[model samples]
Target: MKKKLISMLMIAAMAVSVAACGKSTPSETPSETPSETPSETPAEAKDPSEMTIYFLTKILGNQYWAVVEQGAKDAAKELGIKNLVVTGLASEAEVEKQVQQLQDAVAAQADAIVLGPVDSTAMANPVNDAHASGIPIVIVDTMINTENYDAALMTNNVQAGKDAAKEMIRLLEEKGVKKEEVAEVAIQIGSSGSQTIIDRLKGFYEYWDANAPQTWTVLRDDVKVNDGDISKAVGFTQDFLTAYPNLKGVFGPNNGSTVGFVTGLKEANRTDLVMVGFDFSTEIETMIREGKFNVSTVVQKQYLMGYEGVKQAVELAQGKKPATKLIDTGVLIVDLKNIDNDDVQSIIKPGK
Candidate 1:
């Protein structure tokens, strides 16, 4: 009888526990079944075809910018973007024209803008204004001083500068340049106002100061600004060659400047100096393959810049933030040895 009573008591306790679990407090019970879960319906995707995107390059006609244009156009086509307007100034120093273009884009109520800024500081106010107006600004190749941009796709210029410095050293060493040898290097830049140029020059100087021999020097005080004029760059190169007899290396940090150095060196009948440059052109390609002097160039993925710039702009227009504010397009140091490699050739002759 005692065993049966205990067993009955245990059964009663379990029944009470089950009854308690089955009941719900008023707050714990949902008032009613939701009409639908939040995840059941999502916002509709925006149509890129209805939007107007503007592609503003730093300058037109140069191969570097040409490749960038090609990339942007290709992306626009692939995305089925209906209205893509591509425009740029005749020169990189046309800051006022670019500024006007930005204002005009705003006036036209451009859905998004892909820009390669001519001057970092000069473009800041306009860029900020454009952003404040609710338009997305996607920068390519260069950067503006203000952080108001939606996305910036560019090469890591400072690192490229350091890489150029290292290549310059290697080329010099190949031609029997000794650490103790007294030689000077001259630098030519596209424009003084370009943050791209400024950063590159900074990287080069920083690396050289830390790694170069005491006797070797960069002409910091004599750095030349070509203002994106190849003729001016050539003239400056000639001046450097004439003034600095001990000049052993030349660094040109842009497409026009690089061509200027190559041309000036050939015109001067100089085959003893090492030349390090940026960007890839037929002139640079041929010189690297056939030129007597040591020549190399730091080539950037300019085409990728254009493609990604437009893509990011479209994303922003659709109320999406980019994965990151800045994108490093990357660089390749091409010399004679690697010039013939398939990968190197692809970069230097992207579409060809």
Candidate 2:
């Protein structure tokens, strides 16, 4: 009878947790203020040893995430942030697992959390739980749904998408793609529900629709390809080829799917197509050298993102109010003209 009563109490607590997860409205601006100094230490926070920061990202397998992880670790070292840990989702689709990671971090009495939300809507409950536990949460890379967090560091994904699309349009026009022939472009996205992914797709698609020649109609080949899986994405690309014989341009919002799409191009013997993707991956560098595709991309300032995210979380831990929110961590466009130059190489290199 005693055990049954305890189990009932636990079940009731879990129910309350579900209720807290209810929808949170999206914000045009993050709740916390940004700091001017990219200071070496958590500015005016509590004792360093008492501070702990947990960083969570979307996928674990990619080199991109590896860069973020390195940045977080380095910040902890610089700021003496105790018990600092960085973690990522096992797969892109693992939203629930990612939320659970945040909840567990709070249960461990972490002082603060630096978050990279996979699905913004699904993040409210866990983040609220952390807030209720008196643990500060700082969102980075992507925005979360609630205003209860500290600050966010993000890229202007909409602009990045337009940059990529505009470059592709220029390439097509340069190649003298006649005004009558439509450019059958396809976008193979990494995750369907993520706000970052959605924003990227929206920006690119909107630009392509408005700027491309009147004859060029956007290919509605809406394929959800895994950013982590080389093989599955390659297979999806294979299917796309068989279906769209007139395919012209291809785009991917994340690095893994970009590499996978490139593999598909090589397999189908369609290396002549004008393909543009996000991220300056190793494959992109090699292809640019070989003149394979007029390939170019928008590079995110991920290292700075890593460094600043942890730094801010620590500040929040110390009860220091940040001066800024929506820290637009910057992006740059890479193309054939400058792909081999020092600036481009610097962007592609991580943790520099």
Candidate 3:
């Protein structure tokens, strides 16, 4: 009986040891619970260095284009772009040259292009060709006749013209010149091919016809086509002043024309004539400060147009589309009264 009892106790101890070996130990068990949830992946960032933008202006060596170039450079630096090339013809009438530049940009494998066309219709084919080659183009300052561009950034030119007219009216009133007593007003245009110039003239005419007294006549015959030549503008203004001694106001729809008008007025000692024009320059600023005949100028946001044009082109190159195809950079009327204001100063001397 004692032997059987000892054997039974040994058998129970062996069973207990077997059970302990079959069970998992604390060290063998995992410390973390396996999660059933999935994690979200982040979007990849774009590489700006791979993008190259070409800026083709209507003309170079002008203050307006220079400001635009500076704005584009500022954007390129800020965006870390691989390259920003600015090129254009010497004259605004060089439509064929601009077309060649567009083709060259495509041949160079530019990622995108920003164009201020010399002629709205002449560049349609080249713009379409660029679009066909998968290189996006953004129109700036001026609009092309085609709808193939990725985007167009410009000012409300018609409104800008109306703004100039309104300012002219104000200045005439301040000078104690009654609308009926006013004999004539003359206008100067930079380029007849430029849609921007046409729209401005249209706006100016629309406003003046509706508001001015019936006796006041617009000197349509005296209208001069300067073709961006300041000397032509000056000569035209001198002739107009000599012909229309009763001229109440003069409107220059561009920088060259405005500058020419101011210079001509000074030379002729006819600073008493109210003048309103388009664009901004150091000379225009000085004339305004000196309280000359320059009543005000309708200044477009040219820098913004350039900066935004490049920005949109870069986005297009990166496979992104702009929220809208048309963007108005806006315009402001800068006169002696508001020239020093912060907003006016900002537009007048952009990126300062």
Candidate 4:
């Protein structure tokens, strides 16, 4: 990354602390972490000032969706739209629960729906159902494998993974770590089937295959799929590190798992182990500030996903076609140098 771009990333990370969580408003603060929690009612009394928008993510316990929800809540407050219950299954592996949440939202007569489908095909039925009911659905964070939805607001996951890979390579080069000597680098994926997770792995491996072919190789078996639980994330990471004595680094495709990986690394006192993970969580931010991890690939504008997701949904509900099928929210690489700096803290502060 260029110095200016790095500087900008740092700025966004810091800015996010205050705005990352739904601290600014209630709607975006997830009822559950990545777990999708749909309100039984899905709306208030339908106050004229507040339009209800229902939302669902991959899991409820993962902090990653918190940022996305924060984005949605921020938008609701700004637009006087009531963001319905923002919830999802506890992991990406649960497609049934995810679909149920969408159906619940639609049944409740939500004015609009924002869904982060666990499975592209599984979501088709519920998504189409919602659409047929005159409810507009918008996707954020992860992608639905099919282009069945009206629009997808997502992080540039490929670039996110590539950014992390670049940082890992940079750190390795800085430490005089030879590429060919790497025996094992564990891949901690959120979900193998999810397009977003696949993209992250693809981005990292693609970069290595093209530029560092001889330098790196993935210990695919060492990977842990938390499906998106923090506890599971921590446990998987601990087990991977324990079993793999020669492990050099850990890569996670999702925020909860990556942050959990860092926690496990911290507990193991393996400060030397490199971590190039995804999502911009407060835990990751602290580690980035302390230089505990090598680097973190962050989707800085999480709040925008919720805010803009609602904005997009509202417009679409009014019969306006969103300008794009996949809105590519940018990604960033955050590290120690400017983690606590005013500009850097803006977008990545924990629990903000």
Estimate every model's Cα lDDT from 0 to 1. Answer: 0.89, 0.76, 0.83, 0.72
Q: Could you tell which candidate, 1 or 2, scores higher by lDDT?
A: 1
On residues 205-286, what C-alpha lDDT tens digit does candidate 1 reach at each position? 8888888889999998998989888899999999999999889999998999999999999888789999999999888887
For each predicted model, how many residue pairs clash, with residues at least 3 apart or on different chains? Answer: 0, 5, 0, 32
lDDT (0-100) at residue 63 of candidate 4? 74
Model 3, 201-287: lDDT tens per residue? Answer: 888889988887787778876577887877888998988888787888899988888888888887887877888977898778878
Compared with the true structure, model 3 gives a TM-score of: 0.85
Candidate 4's residue-wise lDDT over 212-234, tens digit each? 64746678655667766678888
Give the poorly placed runs of model 4, Cα more than 4 Å off: 1-50, 213-215, 341-343, 349-352
Deviation from native of the Cα of residue 65 in model 3, angstroms = 1.2
Q: Sorted by TM-score, highest first, which candidate order results?
A: 1, 3, 2, 4
Where is model 3 more than 4 Å wrong at Cα?
A: 1-46
C-alpha TM-scores of all predictions: 0.87, 0.83, 0.85, 0.79
Ranking 1 against 2 by TM-score, winner: 1
Compared with the true structure, what per-residue lDDT tens digits does model 2 show for residues 1-352? 9999999999999999888765443343334324533332455547756776788877785767777777788888888766887778777778889988988898888888888888777887778878888887888777777887878888888888888889888877776678789667777877766677778878888998888877776665566557467677788788778887777777878877788787788777686677777776677667767776767777787777888889888777776778987789888877768876786666567545
- Residue pairs clashing, model 3: none
> Lowest-lDDT window of 10 residues in candidate 1?
33-42
